[model samples]
Target: MPTATRVVCEQLAPTIADLAGNQRLVLETIARDVADGADIVVLPELATSGYVFESAEEARSVALRRDDPFFARVAELLTGTDAVAIFGFCEQSDGDELYNSAAVVTATGVVEVYRKVHLWDRETLVFTPGSAAPPVVDTAHGRVGVMVCYDLEFPEMPRSVALAGADLIAVPTNWPFTDVPAGERAPEVIHAQSSARANGVFIACCDRAGIERGQHWTEGTVIVDQFGWPIDRASGVARATADVFLHLARDKSISPHNDLLADRRPDVYPKGAAR
Candidate 1:
């Protein structure tokens, strides 16, 4: 029998550079969702520091060191809880470079920091690109893989994590409104769904809402099943928040005769090719 894990995606409209207020929101959300029986809670990219930087200088001003007291506060509060939080923020590394990063804070302490591998739009100018693969951590729910915003668009990111034995993928993003033609599923939603099915793992996407620095956001957050379908949400429309069970990700058998992961033909797959 597979164990079930409840996961929640929190969509927030965070004020840019308001680290104190944003930190409050994160802690509060974790408490609320934990009471609601969530085993895993995910927040939007740069949830504490916020997004939309005019320049590298502005981004650096809001970066948090790996040993900042912020994580200590989170660890202090999580001492007796089973919930784990994965959130995005600006990381001020020892090398003096700012990277768009996400951290996993458990009851014990901060376990992992995943730097964003794929930069988006103007982010390339303000943040250093991370060269490491996404980190997969063992949680009570299952092995959780972490990624940020633009990283999910590239199949390689999540696929690499799943291949590394992740039961679920958590993506914290600031999804801006892109021009999707009439009657089309938004690109972000499609990417989440497709990746979940392709990797045969559940996906929890936490996104930001409202405008940031004169730019509008799509605000379409969703939780996808391992088979690539959105879970039934009470909102009856696209919602910024939703919950799903982790055990669903444990099922990789497309049919009784074959398993999705076992069916891969990696031997013949090209290692690298020109796009």
Candidate 2:
């Protein structure tokens, strides 16, 4: 039997520091993707707030509770839709701590809030590291997990999610100019592919584009298949769909090269050592 199909819309755009405008863009894009037959829509990191901010105060000004009026509006728009959405925003958790968080919202409400664990440079001074890893939540779409920008670069992050039985990993990132060797693929693009292929799970990576406050963002939004191959163009900023057989790949153990979870020998590998 053919597997269930899922479409992930990679919205590549720079979000200015406007709460209403950002929320509107997110809602409109989600609506379009759902209408276009997307089972899940992934928006760029910092979709709700501009990534390059002058100060933490500036970032905090736009931060909102998950149940804020803006997100409540998002919930209303998602009502009765089968698709789920993952987007980034500054989350105002209880106390004075602010977290760089991603929200996995379904028809009911916000299902999971994934605070970025690994901080990138100045991000450490602003947002605190998330104490716990985001749990892979079971949805009608599939076993889905969420990760922020820097988290996708580390193999341990996605490996944990895959070990928890996540069929799809939704990543939202604001990648800037880098000097890493991307080979045929750009660095950010190759990183996403590597992350997906390593975990033997589908990757939907949505990235922020355009020059924001002097930082050049590499807007290489891509959707990767089981073998770390791009099913669509690498540099295009459009919605693309890939038909993936998650159960077949998982149950049949059809991961390419068996690198991450597929061929790990945990019995001999020491804790904190590379496998």
Candidate 3:
């Protein structure tokens, strides 16, 4: 049988300084997705703490260390279920450094983490830049990689993980409105499509919305299939909810004699060529 996995993307409006409320929403979303038979659940970046901080002091107030009890609570939400939740948060390392990060949690344990490598404006003032590339994990669902908002903008970000054999890339993003051509989807959504098509991998992007501290966001949450098309529901509409099932192992071949991953031209490419 071709391997199949169910992916869920949630678009939530988080309030600044309301950790309790944000926790409730994420827990409830995961419970709902689990009950619906989803294998992987993704929440937007900064889901634990709202984005847009006035200063590093404010960000530090909400940043959390890995040993923080908050993760234990998040892991408990998946107990007795085979579901995995991927969500972003403000991280405070033991060394007193902060990072914009995301974590993978299962009922049994916390799997892995991906700190945002590409920091947007103002984020540099608060969170420290992650020095490593994205990571791919082995799971029952498949090899899944984690990414946060701005990192998706660079092609190498996803390509590196895809080369490592990622079947799906779960991105937790806070996409703000940007100018796009008329009659076109959000540029970020288009980038997601391009990333999947170029690498022949599925991508599930969960984006947050609503204005926070005067910063507005675009709710462009989407689950793209391995063919880089938006997954559709049984009702023939775009699967725009938290219960969509996806078949990640299908259609990785581009043509009768061509494979998306097998056919590469790295020899002719320069190592430090401009992107």
Candidate 4:
């Protein structure tokens, strides 16, 4: 029998520009989740710096380097466990660039940092777009893929990581509340389900709750299984958690003849638009 991985997505409400407060919240949340036997804890995008920045300078003010001692602190919380925590932060590069990035932290340290490739509305004005591909890190629980908010909107982004043998993809998002039809699910949740089903991989999206800068959030934190159905969902400062067999994601067969990854016809697809 395959061992199930306990995945938890904390729907936190981070205060905008309150770096110190947000950091405290993240630490406290991680500690509580760790104690609760969470194998993998995921937090919302910009959990450290918060979203809705007033200026690039403001965002830069809370940006942290990969080697920041804060990560070491996070690692300490998981010192004796095989737990992993994935969360978003404002990343300060060596140069003048600041990136909307996510960090994969474990008992050892910060293992991988993936900068958000697709910047949303106002994000492009404040942060530089990442040129590197999203990462798939081998974690104690499973093979985890990391990406920030807007990156999950693009089909190619999820497909890229899924092709890289990721068992689960962690998405930290701060989804602005959008009006939806009655009895309908949020578009973001639908995207997650579609992505998970198409790639045959589990997806855990951690979304922030509460209003920030007069902007309300969707608080659409969800954990979807390999078959694309939502296993759990979080509401207002709560968490969505589920135990799943991560190894099952390795199987891509939807039908007896069709294999999700193996059936791709890359050669037939267009690389770029024709002039």
Best by lDDT: 4
Candidate 2, residues 191-210, lDDT tens digits: the string is 77877777778887787767
Which candidate, 1 or 3, would have the higher lDDT against the true structure? Answer: 1
Give the candidates in order of lDDT, highest first.
4, 1, 3, 2
User: What range of 10 consecutive residues in model 2 has the weakest lDDT sum?
Assistant: 249-258
Q: After superposition, how far is residue 186 of candidate 1 from its true place, in Å?
A: 1.2
Clashing pairs in 1: none
Task: Evaluate candidate 2 by giving its C-alpha RMSD to the native, one decimal.
Answer: 2.6
Off by over 4 Å in 1: 1-3, 232-243, 273-275
**How much is the lDDT of residue 266 in candidate 4?**
82
Count the clashes in each prediction: 0, 0, 0, 0
| Tens digits of lDDT, candidate 3, 125-228 | 99999988898888777788889999989999888888888878999988876777789888888899999899988888888877888887777888887767
| lDDT values for all models | 0.83, 0.77, 0.80, 0.94
lDDT tens readout by residue for model 1, 139-162: 877899999988999988888898
RMSD of 4: 1.5
**What TM-score goes with each of the models?**
0.93, 0.90, 0.92, 0.98
Clashing residue pairs found in predicted model 4: none
lDDT of 3 at 228: 74
